[model samples]
Target: MRIRAAEEPQPGVKWIDEGGARMKFLEVDDNTIDVNCDTWASCEDELHARHLFIRWAQFACCWSQGMMASKMIN
Candidate 1:
């Protein structure tokens, strides 16, 4: 699949499902991305977020080639 930025692109973070039950977040037009465990994926209903916690950050930068990824099962 092909992923493209918005028409008028701005610095932001985007989450996506990368098949095989794998999930990830991609940073667009940004040098770095900060993803804390307090984000919306915090609900206990999301099995992937269960181990994550508030103020918990895994990676530092999420550049185009770089990835801040997660998994979602439904």
Candidate 2:
């Protein structure tokens, strides 16, 4: 899969498959990222590929919050 800036005059990331089909649209919101997949297979594949990174990001967010709380208590 290849990720690139959207070519459709939209504000989002586009994921294209090796065969040149668009697999997903990733949009950034204020608080969340939204993914619109072309198919269930694509959705599953993308999520599977990104699962670890997603978890790591969540962990980072939580860790930062914990640090902030600890600092406030000190």
Candidate 3:
């Protein structure tokens, strides 16, 4: 994922989920990005993968909503 400058991710901009865990958004009139994290698949041997995805999704949503990332940040 690209860590855009403060001026890039303007407020009120929404990220559109295209498919396969990928998202698309326009940073500006010309600059655009397709963020992909499509590795989230069924893990035949590891149930932990689902848990990991859930945890990560929660963290991301909270952060986007202006909640603290974590209380245990080191």
Best candidate according to TM-score: 2
Better of 1 and 2 by lDDT: 2
Which should have the higher lDDT, number 1 or number 3?
3
- Per-model TM-score versus the true fold: 0.16, 0.37, 0.33
Scored by lDDT, model 1 comes in at 0.36
The 10-residue segment of model 1 with minimum total lDDT is 13-22
lDDT of candidate 2 over 7-54, digit per residue (tens): 456545434333322334455776444444232223336665476446
lDDT of 3: 0.48
Off by over 4 Å in 2: 1-46
1-74 in candidate 3: lDDT tens per residue? 43445447676443323313544444454533334333345443345555657766875676545523443452
Total colliding residue pairs, candidate 3: 0
Candidate 3: residue pairs that collide: none
User: For each candidate, how many residue pairs have backbone atoms clashing (under 3 Å)?
Assistant: 0, 0, 0
Alpha-carbon deviation at 61 in model 2, angstroms: 0.3
* Arranged by lDDT, best first: 2, 3, 1
> Each prediction's Cα lDDT score?
0.36, 0.50, 0.48
